[model samples]
Target: MDLTVIWAAIIALGLFMYIALDGFDLGIGIIFPFFPDDSERDLMMHSVAPVWDGNETWLVLGGAALYGAFPAVYSIVLSSLYLPISFMLVCLIFRGVSFEVRGKANRTKNLWNLSFILGSAGATFFQGVVLGAYLQGIPVKNGVFFGDAFFWVTPFSFFTGMGLLITYSLLGASFLVIKTEGDLQRRMHGLIWPLTLVLIGFILVVTLWTPMTDPHAASRWFDSPARFLLYPVPILVIVVATFMFNAMRHQHDSMAFLLTIILVFLGYIGLLFSIWPYAIPGAITLWDAAAPRSSQVFLLVGAVVIIPIIIAYTTAGYWIFRGKAEASTHY
Candidate 1:
């Protein structure tokens, strides 16, 4: 019944939607260079073109919701993450422009190709850096940011950035397996096992590093007797990842894709469990970071109406375009 709880849920939902949805498209962009043929790359682009814009809407919604409903969180996080967030926005712009201009100018096609690839990687890396910075705990004094601008630039953050790139690449490869066929899908198949292995390594590193680096987060997982409530999460993640690996071997593209997504969702849920009740990890709880009650109620009313419509529209778009993408396919 608390407005802070309601808004926190809304913000979390929006961010999760953005990560899961836009993540694949960014992954596709990261893997664009693997295909030597421009035509194959076009097939990859076309596969995501129909839904990428809509997928990005969740990002906008998440940012807006945070700024509107939790101004304190917005101000502090934005102040701390200004440079990385700015860089991410610039990369996204280049990527979006590349998508639009690549077909129009054949001479500069290579330029656009590079733009898309770097843009995707840059955006994803910075996002991971932001995540790492938050996970490491942002410094706050009297409800304001007190950290240096370069607080996000560290070895662990860089490792997290690379981990995200690999993860996105894996997601992209899985998507290609689902949406492509013949030679392209075969190439994706070749990439899958290696990507999966690297991703497992990254996960292992994070799993080990997180608790060592942040004792508070460690306590959440280790000290709580009630944590048995989440006992099945790691088990489910392992099961899904195993199924996906097997599905990949069997060339069951759709099943592999679905399983991979489930794995990502389970990880997301695990993270939510670790960071619950806190909007800014150790620094600020959701209620402390929340806006006025009246503002939250007003926003909640609009969100209740708008969110379902967004979901329905996104579902319809995906349903209408459901099928494998071909070289000729373009949105």
Candidate 2:
């Protein structure tokens, strides 16, 4: 493969890792608002306490890979997404800080709790909004950005944000089904069934509207392949997800959680395949936006070295932390 292609694959892999790891936490954040009680919320947070930050490393790696491998696409995305991007980062920051401050500040526990929910909600919403904007094709002007900030945050985009949150939350709850025990685990699976149905509804609505909104996507679904023939992917996803969900219901924790991870990972791969070559969804082809080969090759060396380290540390950390969930005790 060419340098650009090779590096793009690497970045794609990093993105996959990010979605599989940090995605559950982000999904948890998205579902936080729906949590009814304080202890339940603490238990929810506890499910991710062992590895949330580590999961975020994939995000960092993806961002770094973008900067190093495709400077043009990176610039365009940043310029076009400045507002939503800032909002997302602020949400991450507040959510993270609240994790610490919530435990220590006796009087301000409620304040920090609210902050955590706000941060999580705000971040999750904008992330979905950003994806919607990208899928819808951002308005790229001259070399510099000129569009208004609200240009990307439409009703459709907002709905997409909600959809992503729900989807991820279901994934996270399914995760807790395996990672946790007792009443908490039982309760989490109860949420997953209804949540999965709701997520399916979201997918239905989005898929139905996608053709009218973005014709390019329709070509992929319609013109590219016979719908019946392409059923295997989703069929497998459903069957496997059903098996995992059922396994969790029966308290088969490891199989349930691992399958849940595979479900999310496979779904991510599908999305990536859907958006191949187009970094900005019809705005620019991956090849067109790729950086210099020389630059990519040089960076690949460092990436080749550091990526493994990141993976090793991340893997080792999770293996060490693997166990039943406990009440979140503030970081």
Candidate 3:
């Protein structure tokens, strides 16, 4: 058994769970300005309040798993992209604090609101930037990061940051459609189609841009026989988008959110496929970066015991909090 492979799968699953869960709440924060009515904003925040913090659990899991399972990747990637990662953490901190303080402030409510918006957007943008920088390839030499401090800043990284903003905004809107009612719900419904179209545009741009600019990615998609298996990814994306559009048109509340998640899943699969076998894309393969076999075995034992508990609690929290978020409910 390749413990390295198992650990890689665990980290991937953990990161996706974080994206799928926390992305919506961050999206809610991003789109907060669109629904300027205080009551509507309250509803939006409340919609995710119960699960927002819990949703971040997966992020912590992913980070810890990476440090344990692939310490080299952790050190090199962090060193290469320290600025963006640090900014992301700071933004998340501010965002988390705003979540609590915004509800209590009266005279300063607007200030907190701004904080929340900036925090969420800043965190999300930096995350996307990190992803773009990673995809572009982190320079590594002799198991150390060999890149400049600002290696993460580029036109492509900024484009990806904007792309993620749109992606999360759509997730936030679709989620609100399921959680709010009447005019607010209708407004969210209105936002969904436009956001969906914009998301598709971004996906198309990335699909074309990645292959054209990154020969490794281009060859992975075009020159390999794996192309046959990978062809359905975009087709599935189109099909999912169509269903999401119809779901919104018909006011199938939950279906829109569910299908949006499927869209995210497909995109996630595409990204993993694009960088297959590389922990630091074009730099280090997973096997080369993995921790010692004994260390992985020990961590795997703990992960096996702990992951199920996290999943169980996460499931319970959502199930317990399920249903429309009442406007009167402030969290």
CA-lDDT, candidates in order: 0.86, 0.76, 0.91
Q: lDDT: which is higher, 1 or 3? A: 3
lDDT of 1: 0.86
lDDT of 1 by residue, 136-209 (tens): 88999999999899989988888988988988888888888888989999989888877877877787688788
Rank order (by TM-score, best first): 3, 1, 2
Worst 10-residue lDDT window, candidate 2: 224-233
- Most accurate candidate by TM-score: 3
Rank list by lDDT: 3, 1, 2
Off by over 4 Å in 3: none
Where is model 2 more than 4 Å wrong at Cα? 33-39, 141-146, 225-231, 328-331
- lDDT per residue for candidate 3 within 44-63, as digits (tens), equals 89899989999999999999
Best by lDDT: 3
In order of listing, the candidates' clash counts read: 0, 0, 0
- The 10 consecutive residues of candidate 1 with the worst lDDT sum are 256-265
- TM-score of each model, paired residue for residue: 0.97, 0.90, 0.98
